[model samples]
Structures are given as structure tokens and as C-alpha cells.
Target chain A: MAYELYYWPTIQGRGEFVRLALEEAGADYIDVARESEGIAVMMRMMDHAEHPPLAPPFLKDGDTIIGQTAAILLYLGARHGLAPKDPAGGLWTHQIQLTIADLVAEAHDTHHPVGVGLYYEDQKAEALRRSDEFCENRIPKFLTWFDTILARNPAGDAHLVGRSLTYADLSLFQLVEGLSYAFPKATGRALKQAPRVAALHDAVARRPRIKAYCASPRRIPFNQEGIFRRYPELDR
Target chain B: MAYELYYWPTIQGRGEFVRLALEEAGADYIDVARESEGIAVMMRMMDHAEHPPLAPPFLKDGDTIIGQTAAILLYLGARHGLAPKDPAGGLWTHQIQLTIADLVAEAHDTHHPVGVGLYYEDQKAEALRRSDEFCENRIPKFLTWFDTILARNPAGDAHLVGRSLTYADLSLFQLVEGLSYAFPKATGRALKQAPRVAALHDAVARRPRIKAYCASPRRIPFNQEGIFRRYPELDR
Candidate 1:
């Protein structure tokens, strides 16, 4: 059976992580929220009393409902043989993915620092400060950390964990891509100093599957409603 | 060799999750930062050019270094035979743990909405609004979801995923306990409606190992420095 992915219909938010993996692996999956009457079906699934996902970007495989981007990716990666086969390598890949999830959360908080329910206009001042910190410290700190991992990898910088493509690499690529879209100025400055990480992002984007997915309409564009938003004030 | 845990010495922060797993399993480990000259050693270790942890709350088993709270728990849980034996059960357990991690991150952001490096005093206005949203909406939303999970557990409400105790239950106990301490008014209001979640928290705490840990000095007291801070102004 094909996996059912439920996320916000209009945004490439956290759900994009799952979409990327499924796309890269050429897996059979349905983007539920993008279809007609899909959002209502997704909301109904969430409102279910039993085994409902805590939030969106949940993947349904048969009776199993999995949420959390890292968890969903881990499930898809393991099932589709996208993660490392070695136990230690697999665990390391998961660790990196979780860290990426942390980065994603931080990125989202930049605009909604005062309240997720509040508009960016309502929380502009708070977002200004949050984004300043994110651009000045958090982004570099997280990006450099990924760079250090790639530098330390015994299998070389071609991938995050080992010699082949892992979900971590794909996620990192997405992370950098999102940052570049949302905080172009800050990302450009940071990426210059983070050569290895920049190289990895470029490599992942150049992957045949990822490139095809990027060019396809199936890959939704980033927007204000997404985790990473291109607000000029937040970028600088 | 004993397991080595590296985190900041003062707060019952993210490190507490790993601490609970270790304490519950009676695993031989050292809280590196609490030991002699340990904080400096942790700083130095973090500064290492090769194989350094991206952030704190990392575990070192001989030469292997694993970071990320959920990742660390997954490692220790499997290693100590605390995780479910079945792959499906294990993945479900991890799914819940990742959700807990998400809640923890949101909780932390309530108090430090403007910037992590900034003091609460520096961002009081932003925090006030953030905390209000967190207390009024996020807390109830997260707790009610967990309550629903417990109520719908196919095996039983005795555990989150199955009939047996899992690390997710322990983490949830810590989450509720922290929420109670940090946002008593909001938590009190929510718990009244989330009886199953409250009951699960109480049940997890009543476990001999967990009860003992709670009573022990090893369980650091939650304070303003931690993720969940008790800010009277923020709570109401």
C-alpha cells in the first residue's frame, strides 16, 4: 500500500522532509492534503479519538500512523533502505536527523517567537530580535556543527554518515536551501565560511532524484506560511 | 568503561532525560560536569576538532559519542534492554519520544522567545505574550494529545506504546512534572481536563526507580535556568 502523507496543503513546512525522502526514494506515496477534499480528510484523521497524530506531517502506512519529521524520515529511510545498514552508522544518522529537526524548530521560531498563533506583523519586534540571534549565532553554530561532522566522517564528505546518500544529507540540503530562501543574506555570509556544508548542499541538490523533484511541481514552493519564511526584516 | 554524560552542571535541562533513562535502568554512568574539573573537561571535549557532539546531553560509551536527547535515549534504551524488542514497537516508542522532545522545545521557547542568549528580563514583553499562548493553547493541546494517546493505547493505559514501561512514559512524567512546576496555574487548569495524562504522570513517578530518583540529589531541581521556568507573570 502507498504511504499517506498529511500536511498543510499550501506550505512546504515540516512535511517537506517526508516529501523529500519519498521523492528521492521514488516511493509510492500520496500527498493527501494536496488533493481535492484532502485537507478535510486530514483534519478528520487528526480529530480521531484513537491513534491520531499529535500534529501534521504524519505518515500513514497501513494501520501505523507516525508523526514528527525525524521519526517519519527514520521510518521511511529504514523501510526504503535510505539509511545506513550498519547499526552504529544508522544510529549516527538518526542523531544527525534529530539535530536537523532541532535546527528546523529554531528556524520556525524566528518569525513566531512571540506566539505561533500571532501574525508576523503582530510579533515583528520579537521576530526582529529572534532573527538577529538566529542569523548571528544559531545559524552559524548549527551549520558549523554539521560541517564539523562532515569533516570528521571517515567515509568522506560525500555523505553525512557514510559513503552513500543518507536521509541526513537530504535533510541538510533542504535545511540550507530553506535558510537560503528565508535568510538569503545571512545564509550567504555563513555558507562562505562553511565550505564543506555548502559543498554537501550543492551535492544533494545535484542528485538526479532530488534535482528532478525540485524541478517537478510536486515540490511545493516555500512561503510565509512555511517554517522558513522570506521576511526581509528577519533575514538581516 | 562507565557511560559518560556531558551537559551543563547546574540545570535539570535536556540532560535530565538521559539521566532518567540511566537512573531507571541502574546503568553505571558518570554525570561528567558534576565531577571534579568536569565542566571544563566537557567544554574542552565540545571544542574538539574531531567527533565532537553538536550540543550537550551527549553520551560516550567507550569511544562512541551519541548526542540529541531522543537519540541518546534510543541508544541507552536499546543497549540496556529498556526499549521494546520488536522493531515496530521500538519505532512507536521512538515516535512518542520525538513528540515529547518537540513539546520540550516549545516549552523552552515560551520563556526565551526573543533569543536564547538574552535574559528573560531583556525579553519580558515578548516572553509574556509567548508564555500566554504556550500556557493557554500549546500546553492544553500537547497534554490533551498525550491524554488521548494513553486513553487509546491498544495494549493498555499502563504504558504509552505497550503493556511494558518505556522511556516515553518516563519522559512524559518528566514533562508533566516540569510543566506543573513551571506553569502551575496553566498546568492545573489543563490537568483538570486531562486526567489520564495526569494519572500517567503520577503512575510513572510512583515507580520505585523513578520515585527514588525524584527524591535523590541526582535529580537536579528545576529552576529558572532550565527549559521549564516558573515565571509567575508568564503563567497567568
Candidate 2:
């Protein structure tokens, strides 16, 4: 059976991580949320289910519907060659994915520091401080960690986990892209200190499938409506 | 080999989720950071490992080091039957755990809206607004989702997944306890609307091992330094 992915149609947001996995694997699937009555289908699924998904970006197999970006990646990873076959290696890869999720959440909070439901305008001042701290401290901390992970990978610095291009490497590639769009100056500054991470990002981008995905209309561009928004003043 | 748990000794922060899982399972483990030179050992491990952990609350099992609370719980749940045995069931349980992690991060941000490293006093105004949004919006949304998950559970409201307890249940118990201490008035008000979630908290509290662990000094008390902090003004 073909897989069905349900996520917001417009933004790359969390859904992009799952999309990257599906795209790179050359897997057969439909962006369910991008189909006709997609949004309604997504909402109804969220509202009515035995095992209800709390939010979107859920993947529906014949009888199973898996929610959570990282969980979806894990399920897909094992099915494909995206993750390790062994328990130890797989667990480590999953851990790295979880940390990437953390970094993503923090990046979103930089723009919506006061409340996600509230407008960024209402919390501009608060966001300024949040962004400043993120740019100065969090970005360096996270990128350096990624750089270390890359440097320490005995197989090579090309992947975040083992020698293979796991879901983590794909997610990290997206992360660097999102950060560069949202806070270019800060991310650029951090990237200088994380040469290995930068190299991995570039290498992931050069992969045939990912490179095609990026060049295709299938890959959504970063915008103000997405989690990683660009507000010039806050970026400073 | 015994599991070696490493985290900051002072606060029942993110590590509490891992701690609760181990304590409930009656797993043989050492809270390494609670021992002497524990902090140094943790830092050195973070700096020296082939796959260095980004932060603490990492678990060491024989030769492997597992970071991320949800990842650790996933590993333990599979090996110990603390989670469902089936792939679908396990994935759903993991999805719930990730949502709980999201809730925990939001709860922490209520008091640290500007930055994690910044003091509450330094961002008092921003925190007040953040707390208001959390207490009024995020808390209700999350608890309502939890309540829905329980109400939909075919087995019963006794557990978050399947018939038996999962790590998600234990984490939910901790979330309730943390929110209650951090925002007593708001949490009490919200709990009235989420009886199943509230009831789960009470049920988990009565479990023999959890009860003993709660009474034991191993369970660190919530403090200003922890994720769930008590700031009377912010709570209001």
C-alpha cells in the first residue's frame, strides 16, 4: 500500500523532515494535506480516530497512522535504508533526530517568544531579546554540537550518525537551510565555527535525490508564514 | 550491566522523565550525576565521547550512551515492556511522549521567555505575558489533548497506551505534578476541565513503586531553578 502523509500544505515546517525522508528514498506517497479537501481531511483525522493524533504531519499507512515528525522518520527510516539496522545505532540516530526537533522548537520560539497563538508584532520586543540570545548562545551551542557530532563520526564527517545518510543528516541539512533563511547573520557566524557541519550541509544538498527535490516545486520555500520566519530587525 | 543515568543533581528537570521510568520499572541504575564528581564525569563524557551527548539526562547502558529523554524511554520501554510491543503501538506511545516533551519545554519557557540562561527577574515583563498565554492557551490545549487521548483509550483511562502502563503515563504524571507546583491556580483550574488526565495523575501517584519513589529523596523537589518554577506573579 502507498503511504499517505498529512501535513500543512504551505509551509516546510516540521513536515519537511518527513518529506525529505520520503523524497530521498524515492518512496511512493501522496502529500495528503495538499490534495483536494486536504485540510478538511487532516482536521477530521485529528478530530476522529481511535488513536487520535494531537497535531498534523501524521503519516497514514493502510491501518496505521503515525504522528510526530521524529516518530514518522524513525518508522520510515527502518523501512528504508535511512537508519541503522542495529538497535544501538538506530537508537543513537533517533536520539540525534530528537535533538534536532529540540533545535527546531527553539528556533520557532525565537519568533513567537510570547505566545505561538499571538502575533509576532505583539511580542516584537520580547522576540528581539529571544533572537539575540539564540543568535549569540543557542545557535553556537547547537551548531557546534552538530559539528562535534560530525567530527566524531568515525566513518566520516559527511553524516551525523553512522556512515550512512540517515534521517538525521537530512534534517540537519534542512535545519541549516532554515536557520540561514531566518537568521542569516547569526547562522553564518556560527557556521564559520562549524566547518564540518557546513560541509555536511553542502554534501547533503549535493545528493542526487535531495538536489532534485530542492530544484523541484515539491520543496517548499521558507516564508514568513512558516516556523522559520525572517524578520530583519530580530535577526540582528 | 547497570544503567548509569547522568543529569544535574539539583533539579527534577528533563531528567525526571527518565528517572520516573527507571524508578517505576525497578530498573537497576545509578544516578551518576547525584554522586561525587558526577558533574565532572558528565562534562568529560560530553567532551570526550566518540558520539558526545549535547546535554545531560543521557543514559549509559554497557557500552552505549543514549541521550534525549524520549529516546531513553523508547529504549527502555522496548526492552522492559514499559511500552507496547507492537510497532504501531510503540510508535503511538512515542508520539505521545514527544508531545509531552513539547509541553514540558513550553512550561519552562513560561518563566524564561527571553532566554534560558537569563534570570526570571531579567525578563519579568515578558515572562508575565508568556505565562498568561501558557496558562490560558497552551495548558488547556495540551491537557485537553491528553484528556482526549485517555477518553479514546479502548483499554481504559488507566494507561495512556494499550492495557498496561507506558513511559508516556509516567511522564504525564510528572507533567501534572510539575504544572501543579509551577502554576497551582491555573493548573487546578485547567484540571477541572481534564478529569481523566487529573485522574491518571492520581492513579500513577498511587502505584506502589511510584508512591515509594515519590516519597523517597531520590525524587527532587520542584524549585525556582527547575523547568517548572513557582513565580506568584507569573502564575497569576
Interface RMSD (Å), every candidate: 1.3, 0.8
Q: List DockQ, one per candidate, in order.
A: 0.78, 0.87
Candidate 2 chain A lowest-lDDT run of ten: A48-57
Candidate number with greatest TM-score = 2
What is the DockQ score, from 0 to 1, of model 2? 0.87
TM-score of 2: 0.98
**How well is each residue in A38-149 modelled by candidate 1, as lDDT tens digits?**
9999999988836677889899999888877888888888888889877778888998898888889899989888777889898888889999999999999999888888
Q: Mind giving the per-residue lDDT tens digits that candidate 2 earns over A1-93?
A: 789999999999999999999999999999998888999999999999877788878999898989999999999999999999998899999
Instruction: Estimate, for each residue in B1-236, the C-alpha lDDT of model 2 and write its tens digit.
Output: 89999999999999999999999899999999899999999999999998788998899999899999999999999988799998889999999999999999999999898998888899999999999999998888899999999999999987889889999999999999999999999999889999999999999999999999999999898898999999988776
Give the lDDT of residue B37 in candidate 2: 95
Clashing residue pairs in candidate 1 are none
Per residue, candidate 1 scores C-alpha lDDT tens digits across B94-208 of 9889888888998898888888899989988888899889998999998888888888888888778788878888898899988999999999999998998888888988989
